[model samples]
Target chain A: MPQGQPAVVPTDGLTTRQRRNRPLLVLHTGEMKGKSTAAFGLALRGWNQGWSIGVFQFVKSAKWKVGEENAFRALGRLHEQTGEGGPVEWHKMGEGWSWSRKQGTEEDHAAAAREGWQEIARRLSAEQHGLYVLDEFTYPLHWGWIDVDEVVTALRERPGHQHVVITGRYAPQALVDAADLVVEMTKVKHPMDAGQKGQKGIEW
Target chain B: MPQGQPAVVPTDGLTTRQRRNRPLLVLHTGEMKGKSTAAFGLALRGWNQGWSIGVFQFVKSAKWKVGEENAFRALGRLHEQTGEGGPVEWHKMGEGWSWSRKQGTEEDHAAAAREGWQEIARRLSAEQHGLYVLDEFTYPLHWGWIDVDEVVTALRERPGHQHVVITGRYAPQALVDAADLVVEMTKVKHPMDAGQKGQKGIEW
Candidate 1:
């Protein structure tokens, strides 16, 4: 069946265009790969449509450079030069969040996580971007560094037509319940399961 | 945890580089959205790595222009002019296959699907592309139009390090079993549940 077509339609009297224009809260979570990749893909689509795109990476190390970062950055530059496409901004935790700033203690990390969420909340309230990607965000919630209830509340109460997509494994149930869309990447098999390691082009 | 840390380490004697260089057969399947989006993201990664990318669409109509198609095609042209990245080729069933040549029937679609697979097989044998995306490929197999066993056998025995990613729902058991990586997208909730329709760029 087509996606999101639940048997019962709860949206009564809304025109198709009205329903189409509503903002979406999307979650990509589970043990398998591609959650972040899929979010990047959606960001690309949003960028194509002239939607401001903001990517906030929560867990990755500072040195790691995924291919999407390069592609989107280039696209961002192209947008700036040509006045075509949407603006793109990418922020990694190692650079943007204090949690990765020092050889910190657990409490420090928790404080940093809280600060990160606060920053996101500020942006959400300001209506900073059309598409906001909270990449690998579940880790903070999973580790109890960031409260799931607060994240859910911020997302639920955020203003504007901004769309939020959070990607990571072990998503909190409260966030899932609040999300308009959630996809769990279930692993049936993996190359690492067969003793293969991540390669430069494919993995990064 | 990081993906694919196989417990048994089946590739005992292979060097890390050697194991990393092995071709992969990846499947993105399930009831949720993002299967195609994730595949396109991989294709984007492949393009960034200077790898030739080939996309074969089996189900979507020719007139339906997805944002990724436009992005990749533009990237492909940029590569041709600058020689900075890899080449990209996109062929849809409604355009590139036999169905486009004549007034068609279900049998014609089956024929086109078969011909499409044959072309991909030829490319696999020739190692023409570093990454091959068979978009919406499951429908033919699910409909009994294409033989799943043959596909599995070909992929298992294929030459070179060309990666293949097939995206669609209802993937065959044999294909899933033979795949190096398989991810099933489980839907928890969707915007359509609230009677929201697909928006341009977001859905196409």
Candidate 2:
């Protein structure tokens, strides 16, 4: 509530319940940290709401284990054992989209990215999850590995109440136009600016 | 890695281990969302690292049960019973810093905010927690309820390895200059721009 609401108002005459129920397409893109982290936080919220959560990691290496993944995976296990929260499915495109650990070539990486998008599309069509977090997804789109038009089309046409969040720097304008919410993180200062290196628990 | 590192290098020639061990002062502020949410995500990371986590909510009403609080509280319980994660202590200034549900006068709220900051300073001095999340703390300094100079001095002169993250809009210039890291959340687009109201699991 600190930031005043925009002057624009919804033209669609829907009830509050209807508006609240509508799925959201959120994009977190900017030149600062915490975009993916914010998305993960959103997933945590959805999990607490008993909504199925799906996380797809694109740029981060599979070997680099982030803490949110550990916490969410643990929560997922808790859900299975006690049914306290929603189920979670985590997949890493950095792992080559399959069990094999080999990183073949640029073409291979592109193909893997496309394959990952295809799988997301399948899940969206099937309504497999209520909250979909495409962590570091902007890179593929920015690099031209994935077609932005196709992604926009698929997201616009997706069925069911599925909320999607894509996070990364240099998010394309097409995606921005299609998204219901977009946040651009601007860096005011950083420790690294002061010549401090990234620490284990703070950065990753 | 997305935002380029600052050109300034540390003048102190500390070893990698020594530099990594130093505590950080992080500030998240701007006219956008996710400042507090991102701080919560950082707390989640600290919990995964088996570090003590302290969260002090300054602005949000105590009666509002946000999802991150629920998840962190659950994680805290897990830590106590099985020692799976770290211990978490959450306090809210909105509830007058007490367990009793009472909305006191404005003076009472101001008093509670100061008390909360004093407790944080004590904890920092005592090295009580590895990570301390001062959620929505910027407002106190901006509103002149707490002294920014005192805060900066306390943080700069504090003992032990205590990392603090302060989040809110309208953060004071003095506080921003004092922080080791500062992120300004800029709004490109927001759902509220479309006249959609904040909903459960998403807003809280």
For model 1, the stretches where C-alpha displacement exceeds 4 angstroms are: A1-6, A11-13, A98-108, B1-5, B11-13, B95-107
The two-chain DockQ for each candidate, comma-separated, is 0.62, 0.66
How far out, in Å, is residue B24 in model 2?
A: 0.8
Residues B82-184 of candidate 1 have per-residue lDDT tens digits of 7756899988885446334444444367777888899889889998999999999989999998999988888888898899999998899999899989999
TM-score of the A chain in candidate 2: the value is 0.92
Judge the docking of candidate 2 as incorrect, acceptable, medium or high: medium
Reference-based lDDT, residue A42, model 1: 87
Q: Pick the candidate with the highest DockQ.
A: 2
Error in Å for residue A90 of model 1: 0.8
TM-scores computed on chain B for all candidates: 0.92, 0.92
Model 1 chain B lDDT-worst window of ten? B98-107
Q: Could you give candidate 2's per-residue lDDT for residues B1-204 as a string of tens digits?
A: 534553665768986567766899999888888788788888878889999999989977777778888788878877898888789998887757744345545546677788888988888889899999999999988899899999999999988788999999888988888898888888998887776777777887
Chain B TM-score of predicted candidate 2 relative to the true chain B:
0.92
